[model samples]
Target: MPGRSHSGGVIRRLAPLALMPAGAFAVHQLRYWLAFAGRTGLLLQQQGHAYLHSVVPWIVLLAAIAVGVFLQALGRAFGGQCSLPRQTVSFGALWLICAASLVAIYIAQEFLEGLFVTGHPAGLAGIFGYGGWWSIPAAAAVGLVLAVSFHGAHRVLHAVADRRARPAVRVRGPARARAPRHVPAPALAPLADGWSGRGPPR
Candidate 1:
């Protein structure tokens, strides 16, 4: 319970910070796809392509959830009673780490984009243009949402597992009848030469 309490507290405190990263990632991806579609006419030119591209963000989000579930299962199998809290902390940490990594990559991409300016560019600059300093906050928001969603899903899974594990059959037979079978004691052999039952063997 203490571990659960501590983990819950930490997640609550870090939720807002975590959301920034998740949101940033989501927005960045969304913008990238929209721009790509507009420039290439891929969405309009190809049947079903627009719809498929539109679902990319959802697919990515679901993948994140899958990762969370996998982590939760792993923790439960390995950590027993402390599984939930351990899983929650692990999921939160995963989001935080992912956000940090993306932020680093974004910065590097921005720098590279700036360095490679040319007259006949292929829109790499536009694709990597600075989306303002606000992307950091957006990324954090996304991460926060991911962590909270993972926690909620984890709790739901635990509840479902607990419900499914309840005993289905209850014993109600008579107590004496239900008692384990007992073997009768063997009849004692006739004592030798009038020896008493309490005395040691002759």
Candidate 2:
């Protein structure tokens, strides 16, 4: 029971913590951009492409792995058994969250750029351009798909685990029903002996 309870708690806690890597990666990217703004114009002009391509991806990858290890440790702590499928799901969810969060940040950056750099008129159109409005529906569709897929996968995992455990339960049932070695069995033993013609004297 404790194992089951602990596994449930682990799932609950790890699900939310799954978002941490993406969030941290985003913050790191933001910090890099901010620091870039402080560089000399010559350095900025020369190193912009290098910084984006080489440094950013590695930082994001490391952050993602760090978050993954943390979640795995939490899973182990709570007695949750990890398998390949479960790890895949966890990593898939992490990447999905990271992609979505980055898109959201980009959208925000678009609005900020328009307001501060382009001096756009403030309104709904400024927040999201007329064409950019489509992102809302696109994001909604993506979220729905991810949610349904995750729900189906979770159900399948539970079903498979239940099926695998069923055989063990069946195997243990007869063992439990077996008469205990320490239990006195005079009544049944005599019945067995009487049938076999080796019963005790009257």
lDDT of each: 0.52, 0.48
Model 2 Cα lDDT, one tens digit per residue, 1-202: 9999777556554553444434433443443344444553443334232333465566567556545654564444344343323434554574466447645754675566456543443455543443445444444444444445445545554555545545444334444466757967556664565565565679
Task: Specify the highest-TM-score model's number.
Answer: 1
Q: Give RMSD to native, each candidate.
A: 14.0, 14.3
Error of 1 at 82 (Å): 14
Candidate 1 residues 49-111, lDDT tens each?
243356566656656655554555545434333234435367668678656755665555445
Flag regions of model 1 displaced more than 4 Å.
1-25, 29-95, 108-131, 168-202
Candidate 2, residue 40: how far the Cα is off, in Å = 29
